[model samples]
Target: MTTITLGRYLWERVYQIGVRTIFGVPGDFNLQPLDYIYHVDNLRWVGNQNELNAAYAADGYARIKGVPGVLVTTHGVGELSALNGVAGALSE
Candidate 1:
């Protein structure tokens, strides 16, 4: 059996979906998990100042690139802050 970290698995899935650019804000809980970016080919992470902005950027990227947008954020308040932007992305 083959074993892989969730971070690596997540990135591999994202890469499979044609996500070359990721937009998000790294938080305490997500920092380590996001390190899997380095192991993927042509996958680059774009750090934002906050979750809200990250969500918006991801939404924008998804629209422009015609692929899924990946967003990373911490728990609680950080997740909540991105609600509006994510909702917008879903609506459009």
Candidate 2:
């Protein structure tokens, strides 16, 4: 089998698992993985204005698509900002 970096491995796995669309706000820490994921065929990365919106969007996508939605964000504030939407999703 061809060798792949950890990022590529994750990207491929997500694709294999039928995750055709991902939503997130890009930042330095996560840019590499996002780039790799976006490059993969049949996979699309949906850009959001912020993490909270991304998480909410992902949740909506999951409900309609019957698959887990994913969101990537910057560390610290980015993650914190998503908590509200995440909580709402979890509570629903």
Candidate 3:
């Protein structure tokens, strides 16, 4: 077993789960995780115009790739803006 920070573990899981790209609007709460994810090879972080659009982009990518596309939005409003797409993906 390898010991690593929670952020690293989370990002690593995303990589292992076959996420080659991520989409989101960066913000304070999620910045750390995003920074960590940046160091991962073959993982491209695609910043979107807004959380809602970010969610849509991620959902679309996931649909085509068959992998859970990553979306890193901040807490509160940013996260809320992304909820609809997330819920939609969950339903499907």
List model 1 lDDT by residue over 1-92, tens digit each.
99998989999999999999888887778889889998888999999998899999999898899998888887878788899889988896
lDDT by residue (tens digit), candidate 2, 2-89: 7888887887888887778989998888888887885678889889999999999999998998888888888778798898888999
The candidate, 1 or 3, that scores higher on TM-score is: 1
Off by over 4 Å in 2: none
For TM-score, the strongest prediction is 2
| Each model's lDDT | 0.88, 0.86, 0.86
Alpha-carbon deviation at 23 in model 1, angstroms: 1.2
TM-score of each: 0.90, 0.92, 0.85
Off by over 4 Å in 3: 90-92
RMSD of each: 1.3, 1.1, 1.9
Prediction 1 TM-score vs. true: 0.90
Indicate whether candidate 1 or candidate 2 has the larger lDDT: 1
